[model samples]
Target: MAHYRASESKREQFRRYLEKSGVLDTLTSILVALYEEPDKPNNALDFIKLHLGAAGPDPADVEALRTEISELQQKCEALTEENNELKNKLMQCEPAPEEKPAE
Candidate 1:
């Protein structure tokens, strides 16, 4: 019983270490990209080799920002369309009475 517990603990520790070692994040795509493009900007090691930190626009981060910008632009377009639709509906609706109601 104690032996199994010890083995389980060791396995758990190994699993955690493996996860931290990036078996979890699975950089397979990044590695493949690096293999395809040696000069590629955001390979796992490229950042460290280039001493990238506290500086602007890491390549990976820029790609993420571009994705975010695209999402925001879509949202803005959708909102604008919705706003125009609401305005058109408002224009079609009957207007409120100009005169005050009797007190």
Candidate 2:
């Protein structure tokens, strides 16, 4: 009997904590939005996880970012090659000055 009462008290405290934190309201709102979706998700848990940002970024956005990064990397490589080529040409054009012997 004592254990049962303690468990109930703990549950009530947890419920109050959830209410105070607004977690109950946020969860209710998300669930309500999911309920209203016309084309409901096959996996309700996945939908909730996605909405909660636990599923990472959208695939299309990730792909777009990857393409942009790849293009930038190529551009950077080309610029580096061009810079090295220019430096080599400059070095070839300007001969090193003769070193003087110590007196």
Candidate 3:
């Protein structure tokens, strides 16, 4: 009975500390956002980590990176086509070497 009371007291103290530090409020807001999402995430902890900015870059940044990647891919394709065309043109312009009559 004494150990149970001590544990309860510790839990209450930790809760108070979280409230005092505004962590409770922040967590509440994140939870509310998670609750309101149309497609709820399968993992609550992962959702919370992403919302808290612990997972990685922001969504906007990710979108920008995706756009840049698409542009680079297009540019690479165009350059590859151009290189192939130039090689074909060079091959057509080159003549076969003449063979020597005697060694």
Candidate 4:
């Protein structure tokens, strides 16, 4: 009897924790949205995940960012080559330092 009472107490605490944390409310809202959809999604899990923002970023946004990164990488490579060439030219123009005679 004492063990059963302890289990019930733990369950109550967990339920209260969920209620206090707003998780219950968020879940209820998502379930309600799913319920209200007319043409229900084929995959209910995916729908819930999408609603909860766990499905990852939008594909179009990801593609756009990838394109931007590629362009920036190409530009960086060009600038690096130009800088190396300039450094080489500067080295050629500078005279070599003469070594001092050993004491």
Tens digit per residue, CA lDDT, model 2, 1-103: 9999999999999999999999999899989999999999999999998877788888999999999999999999999999999999999999899999999
Q: List the residue pairs that clash in candidate 1.
A: none
Off by over 4 Å in 2: 58-71, 91-103
Alpha-carbon runs more than 4 Å astray in model 4:
58-64, 79-103
Model 4: ten consecutive residues of lowest lDDT: 50-59
- Using all chains and alpha carbons, the TM-scores for the candidates as numbered come to 0.40, 0.69, 0.51, 0.65
Please give the RMSD to the true structure for each candidate, in Å: 11.1, 4.1, 9.5, 5.6
Write candidate 4's Cα lDDT for 7-100 as tens digits.
9999999999999999999999999999999999999999999999999988999999999999999999999999999999999999998899
Question: Which candidate comes out best when scored by lDDT?
Answer: 4
Residue runs of model 3 more than 4 Å from their true location after superposition: 58-103
Error of 2 at 9 (Å): 0.7
Off by over 4 Å in 1: 1-55, 96-103
Model 4: per-residue Cα lDDT at residue 43: 99
lDDT, model 2, position 91: 95
lDDT of 2 at 55: 82
Query: In candidate 1, what are the lDDT values of residues 1-103, reduced to their tens digit?
Result: 9999999999999989988898645555445545676575744575443443434567899999999999999999999999999999988896865997899
lDDT value, residue 25 of candidate 3: 98
